[model samples]
Target: MAATPHPAHRFLTMKAAGVTLAALVIILFAGLRFVHLEADFPPGVSGSGDLYTDEGAYSSAAVRWVTTGQWRLEGDFNPAVNLPVYPLIQAVTFKALGLSLGHARLTSVILYLLLMAAVWALARRWAGPVTALIALLVMAVNFNAFAFSRLALLEVPMTLFVVLGLLAAARGGATGTVLAAAAFLLALLTKTAAGFALPVILLVLLWRPEPLTRRLAQAGLFCALTGLGLLAYYFVLVRGHLPDYQTYFMTNVLLRTQGGLWDLGRALVRIIWYGRQFDPVLYPLALLGAAGVLVVGGKLRRHPLFWISVVWIAAYLATLATQNYAPARFYLVLAAPVGLLLGLMIEHLARSGRRGAAGLLAGVVILALAVSGGRAVDYLRHPQYSWASMMRELHGLVRQDGRENPVILGHFANSLSLGTGLLSLNDHYTWKSSLPARLERYRPDYYVTLGGIEAPIRSVLERYGTVEPVRTWDVFHNYYTGEPVALYRLTRKSPLEASRP
Candidate 1:
C-alpha cells in the first residue's frame, strides 16, 4: 500500500491546486472581457430600445465634463434622472485622459475584474479555494454580468461597490467597517436601489453575536459619518447642480414602496426568474445552493455575514420584483451571492465522494464561458454595437446636407444623436405629436429617424424634404441581426432666412 500523505503535504498540495485553478479562471475571464475593448457599446445598447438611453445620457455627461468643466446637467445630459457616482467617475477619468467611450467602458471592465477578485477572496474565506475558484468561474461568464461590465453605465459600478461592502462586512475588521461604509455611500450615490438592502446590513451588524452595544455604536457612527460627509459634499459642491434630490428620493424610493407586501412577494418571484437570462445552465445549480442555505439556515443563523447576504438578496429581489417593470439587469446584485451558494454546493458534493461533481461544475462553467465569450465577440464585430458610430454617421449626414444646425426631433434616436454631439434645436421637444407643426416651428434643417419609422417621423420627413438613403447597421442582443437603420436628411427652403440670403 502506498504510504498516506502527511496532512501538511496534503494541505500544501490543495493550496497549490486552488491557486492554479483560480489563475486559470482569471485568465479566461480577462480574455473574454478585453476581447473587444474598443468596440461599440454592449448588446443591450444596440437592439434593445430603452437600455441604450441611459448609456447615451451617461456618455454625453462624460463628454460634457471633459470638454467644459461644468458638471451641471445639460438638456441632453439628464442628471436628474440618473445617479451621479458612475458618471462622476467617468468624468474624472475623462478629465485625466481625453474622452474615449471605449476607454470609459474599459474602466467599467476593470472594475468588474476587481469585483471578481473580491468575490473570489470572499468566497474563499467562506468556502475553500476550489469553491472560490468555481464561484468566480460562474460569475465570470454570467451573461448579464458580462454584458453590463462592458457598458458605460452605473449598474456595474454599483454592483461592484455592493460586493465590496459585503466583502468588507464579512471580514469584520474595523478597517473593513470603514471600507464598507464608504462603499455603501458610493452605492447610494450611484443608484437609489442601494438603499433597499442597506437596512439589512445594519440589522445584521446590530444583531451579531459580538458585543451588541459596541457593534450598534459602530454601526451608528458609520451611518452618521457617512450621512454627514454626503451632506457636506452635496451642499458644498453638488447641491444646486443636482435636481431636487429629495423629490427624486421620494418618488423613486418612498412612493415606490407604497404597494402592499403581496406586491413585494410577486416582485421577489420575478427577480428570481430573471436570473434565467444570465445563464440557464447555472440556474438549477443556484437553486440547489439556495435550498442548501435554507436547509442549513439554523447553523448559518449565527453567521452574521451569511444572514446579511441572505437578507440583501431577499430585499433586493423583493423591491425590484414589485416595480412595474423588471429587467434582467436589475438582478445583477444576485450574481455574487448566488455564485457563492453554488460554489458551496459544489464543494459539498466534492466532499461527499462525488468526484464527478467537480468535473461537471467545470464543464458547465467552461460551456457558459464559451457562449458568453462568443456573444461578446459577435457584439464587438457588429457595426450596430457602437451607438457612438451610429450617431457620428447621422451627424455627418446632417452636416453633408448643408444643415448647419438642425432641430433634431425623436425619442430613442435622439439619445444617441444628441449624445454623440449633435446639436438639437430644442431640448424639450420631441417629434412625438403634431410633428408637422413642431417641425415647422423648429424648422429643423434635418430630420433623423431610427428603429423603423413611426407616423410622426414619416409625416415630418415627407412634409419637410426628401429623405436621403443613408447606411444600414446591425443590432445585437445575444447575437447579431442586421437591420436597415437609415439616417435621413430633410431639407426645407427657409422663408425669411432664404429671403435674407
Candidate 2:
C-alpha cells in the first residue's frame, strides 16, 4: 500500500495543482484566441476585411493615421466617434506590422492577455489561488469575452485598466490609491463606458477603516487627480471639438433615461439573454455565486473586495439596463466580476466539503470552453460571415474600371477603402441625413451599396447618377440560413460632378 502523504506534503501537492490549473487557463486563453486567426478566408484577402464594420472604422482610422499623420478619421477630426488612445495603439501596431487586420487585432489579443493577468492578480488577492484559477477559466472561455479578444475594440483594454484600478485600490495605501486613480483615468480615456467604475471606486475608498477625515481626503484626492487627468486629455485632444464631445455624452446619458417601465424590463431580459449566449453555464454559476455572496454576508461585509465586486456588477447592470441600447460587448465590464463571483462560489463549495458539487463546477468550465471555443472556430472558418471575398471582388472591379485611387461613398465605404487602397467616406451606421450633402461635398467617383439601400437613399443615388449592378455575394449566418446582399455601383453624372466643382 502507498504511504499516506504528510499534511505539509498534501498542502504542497495542492499548491502545485493550483499552479498547474492557472497555467492551463492561460494556455487555453492564448490558444483559443490565436489559433485559426488566418482560417476561413479567401486567398490573399486583405486583413482589414476581417473586422466588423465599426471595427473596420477603428482600423481604417489607424491606417489613415499611419499614412496621413492624423489620428482621427481622415476628413473628420471628431473625437466623439474615435478615441485617441486605442487608435494610437492600433497605429503603433500598424507601424510595426505594416497594417494588416491580423496585426491590428493582435493588439486586442495582447490587451486581453494582460487583462487576464490583471484579473488573476485581483482574484488571487481577494480570494485565493484556486478562485483565481477558476476566475481565469470562466473569463477565458466566455464567448463574448472571447469575441472581443479577437477585435480591435476599446472594451477589453478599458476593462484591463478598470481591473487594475480595482486591484490597486484593494491594496489600501497612499501609493496604491494614487495608482488606482491613474488606472481609472486611463480607463475613462480609453472608453467612456468605464465611468461606471467610478462610483464603485469611490465606495471602496470610503469603506477603508481610516479616520473619516483621512478617508475623505484620500477619496477627494483620487477624484481630483482623475478630474485633472481628464481635463488635460480634454484640452489637448478634444478642446477644438468640445461641443461635439458634449453632444455625444448627453445623447448617451439621455438615452439611459428615455424609456418607460416595459422598456427597462425588456432591456434587463435582453441583458440576461446576452449573458446566456456568452456563457450559458457560467452565467448561472455567477448568479449562484452572487446569491452565495449575499447569503454569507456576515463574513463578507467587512471585506472591501467583496463590496467592490457587488458594486461593480450593480453599477454595470444599472447603467446598462438604463441605456436605450446596449450591445453584448458593453457587458465586458461585467465579465471579470462575474468570473470572480463564480470563483468564489466554487471555493465556497470546496470549503463546505461538497466535492461532487465542485467537480460539477469543473465540468461547467469545460462546457463553456466547448461551446464558446467551437463558436470561435466556426466564426473563423467561414469567410462568408466577414464578406472578405466580396470586398476583394469590389476592389477588383474598381481597378478594372480605371479609377485611380478614387473616393468611394456609402455604407460599405470602409471595406471598399481598405480593400482598394483608396479613400472612403463612411460613417458606419449613421449619417443617413447627410448622405446627399456628403455626396455634394466630396464628389466621390463611386457610390457603392451593400445589404440593400432604403427606398429614399436609392432615390437619391438614382437622382445623382447611374446605378449599375455589381456582383452579389451570399452571406451565410449559419449552416441553415443564407442571404444574398447585392452590391451596386452608382456613378456620378458629369453634370453633378461639375456642380460640386
Candidate 3:
C-alpha cells in the first residue's frame, strides 16, 4: 500500500539488522547459561553421560576450604590436583552463593559465557559478523562443548585463558605480544596440561608481518616472559612443595598412560568415533575448515589466523595421540580452533558472492545448529547431576550401623566422606607403598569404590572378604566405559561365623 523504499536503503537496513542479530546471539546464549543453573539429577533415570571426575573433586575441595578453611583433597596437599586458579574461583563463588555445588557450577556458566564472548570478538575481527555468528553457534550448540562447558571443571576456564592469550596475540604489536605471553602464562598456571599448547603459542610471532629483526625481538621477549613466569611459579613461590607437585604431575597427568605409534592411531580413531557421536557436524566441519584455511591462504606465513588454526589442530591431535587413555574431554580444547576454522570457512564461502551458494551453505549450517539446539533443550529438560536413589540407599545403609560411623574407602573418598560424615580414604591419591599399611591401620568396614585398582585392597582384606552391596551404580566415567559404583561390605571371618558353613 506504500511506496517501495530504494534498493540501497533496503540493503543497508537489512545489513544493520543482521549485525544487530549477530551481536545479540552471543548475549542471548550467555543469558541462557544462567537458566537452569540449578537443574540436575531427575530421579529414577541415568545421566546424559559420564561426569568428569574433576568436577566434583574441585567442588568438594572448595567446599572443604569454605567450611573448614582448608584447600585440600582429603588430607593431602597434592599441588597438581590443587592447581590454585580454578579451585580458587570455585571457592570465591561458593563463598558468595553458599556451599552447594549448584552455586559452584555457576562459575563454569559465567566463564563459558565469557569464553563465547571472547570467541565472538576474535572471530568478528578475523572474518565478519556472519563468521562470528557461525563461530558462536558451533561453540554453543556442539554437544561436547555444550556439555563440559556447563560443568564446574578446569577445562572451560583453562580454555578461556588460552583463547584470551590467542586473541591478544592477534593484536599484532610488541605490547600485545607481551600481554599475550602473560595470558598464556595464566593459562599454564590454570592447568599444567596447558603446557602442551606452549609451542604453538610461541610461534605467534611467525605469523606477524614485521621485519625479521622486529619479529625476533618480540619473540625473544615473549618467550622470556612466559618461561620466567613458570620458573617463578614452580620454583620460587612454592619452592618447598615442588617435590609433591612434581610427583603428582609426573605420575598422574604426564605418565598416566604410555603407548606407541599404533596407540596413537587408535587414539585418533577413538577420538573421531566418539567425537562424532556428540555432534556429527562440528568435527567434520572443523576438518573441512582447516583444509579450507590452507588452500585459501596460499602461503602459510601470510595468513596468521589460518596458520594458527592448522597448527593448533595438529598440535592438539599429537598431544591426544600420545595419551593412551583417550578421554573425550581431552579433545575439548580443540573447540576453540574448530570454531575459528568454521568462521573462516563460512567467511570464505560468503566471499564467493553467489547468493544461491550462500543460501545452500546457510541452510546446512542452520540445520546442524538446529539439531544441536534440540539436543541441548532435551538435556536441559532432563538434567543429569547425580543418582538420587543411590544417595538414599547409601545413606540408609550407612545409618544401619547405629552404634558408630563406618569407615569408607573409594576413589570419591572426599565427597563420600563429606556426605556420610565418616573417615574415608581416596584410593587414587594414596601412594602404593603406603597403601597396604594404611589399609591395615584403617581396616575400613566398607569399601565404596568408584573404579580404581581394587586388587591391592582385595589382597589386603582377604581375611575379611567383601560382600557386594544390594545396589550397583550404573554410570559411565568416560567414553562408554561403565566405571560402575560398588559399595562392598567387608566383615571379619571370625566375627560372623554362621553355623560352621
Candidate 4:
C-alpha cells in the first residue's frame, strides 16, 4: 500500500516541480540560442536572406556607426527606408562589443529572454503556473518565434514590448493603467504594429466602466508623452532630419488600405491557413479553441481582458488582410492571442473531465514541438542550407577580394550587400533612370546579380564591364529536382578610368 500525502505537502511539492520544469525549459531555450550564435553571419537561414532585409539594413547602419561614429539612417542614399530606433539600438550593441555578427545577434537573444519573462508573467496571470509553464514551452519551441529571435530584426523587440504592454494592461490593479500606457508607448516606438493594439485596449477600458475616466486620462497622458519624446528625438537629436512622414505614412499606412475586399478576403484565408504551417497537427485544436472562445460568449463578453485580446487579434488580422502582400510572418502577433485561447480551451477541457481531449491537445503540441525542434536543429547544424549559404559565400568572396571599398548594384540585394559590407547602389527590381550613370557613380569593383534578374544585369553590365560567373547557391527545395533550387551570380567591373581609380 502506498502512503497518502497531506494536501498541503502535495501542493508544495507540485509547485516546486512546476518551477523546476519552467526553469529547465528556459535553460534549454537559452542553450539553443547560444549554440547557434556564431555559426553564420546573421545567425539563422531566414536571418541571412531576403527575409531579413530590414535586419541587414540595420546591421549596415551599425557598421557605419562603429567605423565613422555617425548614426545616419539613410541607406544607399535612400532616406525613405530609415527606421532609426532599431538601428540605434544595434549601433549601441556594436559599439559595446566590436562589429561582429554574433554580437549583433546577441542583442536579439537578450530581447528574446526578456520576452520569455514577459510571456511567463502574462500567462501566469491568466492561467496559473502550470499553463504558464506550458505557454513558455510552446513559445520556446515555436519555430517562427525562435527563428526571428535569433536574428537582428525589429520584430523580436516589437513582440517583446507588446507582450510587456499586454501584461501591464492585464494587471487589474491601481497601477495597471499607468504601466500599460507606458508599455504601449514603448511598443509603438518599436514598431507600427503597436498602433493596431490601441482599439482593443480602448474597448476593454470602455467595457470596464468603473475606471473609465482614469484609464482614459492615463492613456492620453502616455500618448502625449510619447509624441513629445518622438518630436524631441527627431528635431533635437537628429537635427531636424525628420523622415518624409507624409510619403512613408501614405505608402506604408494609408495607401496600403487601397486593397479591395476580395484581396483582403484572400489574404485572410491564406493567413489563417498558412499560420499553421509549422504545426499542422495542432491546427484543428486551434480552430476548436477559437470556436470555444466564441461559444463561451457571455463569460467572454463580460471579461474585459478576454474581449480585448479577441479584438486585438481580429483588428490585427484585418490590418494584415488589407496589405498588398501577405506572408505568414505578418500574422505573428496573432500567435499570443491564439495561444491564450488554446490554453483556455485546454483548461476548460481538463476541468470538464474530458481527459482524452486534453491528451489529444497535448499530443498535438508535442508533435509541433518535435517537428519545429527538428527543423531548428537541422538549421543550426547546417548553416549552408539554401539562401544562407549564398550570403555566406558572397561575404567570403568580398573578404577575400581585399577590397574594402567595393560597391554592389542589384535589385532586392540588401541582404547580400550588407552581409558583404559592400556599398549598395540601388535595390530596384527593374532597371530605370540612368542605370549606367548610377553604376558609374558607385564605381563598384564587383556587380553581382541573382539568376532571375541576370538578363537585365547583363544588359546593364555591357556598358560598364564584362559579366562573369562568380558562384551559384541553392534556394529552398525544388519539387522537380527534389533538391534545393540554385541561383547564379554575375559579377562585373568598372570600365571608366575614374571608376578604376
| Cα TM-score per model | 0.77, 0.85, 0.81, 0.79
lDDT for every model?
0.61, 0.67, 0.64, 0.59
lDDT per residue for candidate 3 within 1-501, as digits (tens), equals 998999979977986886686556556555656667645422222232335245555455566677657665333425434376787787788778776545666798889888888877777665667777777777776656676676677778887888788777767687788888888887776776676666666677666667888777877888898989877776654576655576566656678554677877888776556555435776776776566645665432255566666777777666656665555566667776776666666666656565566557667766887776676667677665354345456768877865364666666654543334455555665465655555556666777665543676667666445555645675333223457667777664554553244
lDDT of 2 by residue, 161-279 (tens): 89888877767678878999999988887787788899888887777778998888888888998989888877886777665465445544554563888988888777666655446
**Which candidate, 1 or 4, has the higher TM-score?**
4
Q: Give the poorly placed runs of model 4, Cα more than 4 Å off.
A: 1-19, 38-49, 73-82, 170-182, 203-210, 222-258, 298-301, 348-360, 378-396, 399-404, 417-419, 429-440, 452-458, 464-466, 475-501
Q: Which candidate is the best by TM-score?
A: 2
**If ranked by TM-score, best first, what sequence of candidates would result?**
2, 3, 4, 1
For lDDT, candidate 3 versus 4, the one ahead is: 3
For residues 93-150, write the lDDT of model 4, one tens digit per residue.
8778876666777898898788878877777765656566666666676676667667
**CA lDDT, candidate 4, residue 495:** 42
Q: Enumerate residue pairs that collide in model 3.
A: 41-385
Better of 1 and 2 by lDDT: 2
lDDT of 1 by residue, 46-105 (tens): 334445355645455555555555444332324433466777777777678666656677
For residue 280, model 1's alpha carbon misses the true position, in angstroms, by 1.3
lDDT of 1 at 68: 51
- For candidate 4, the per-residue lDDT at 43 reads 33
lDDT of 3 at 444: 67
* Error of model 3, residue 441, in angstroms: 6.7
- Pick out the ten consecutive residues of candidate 4 with the lowest summed lDDT: 478-487
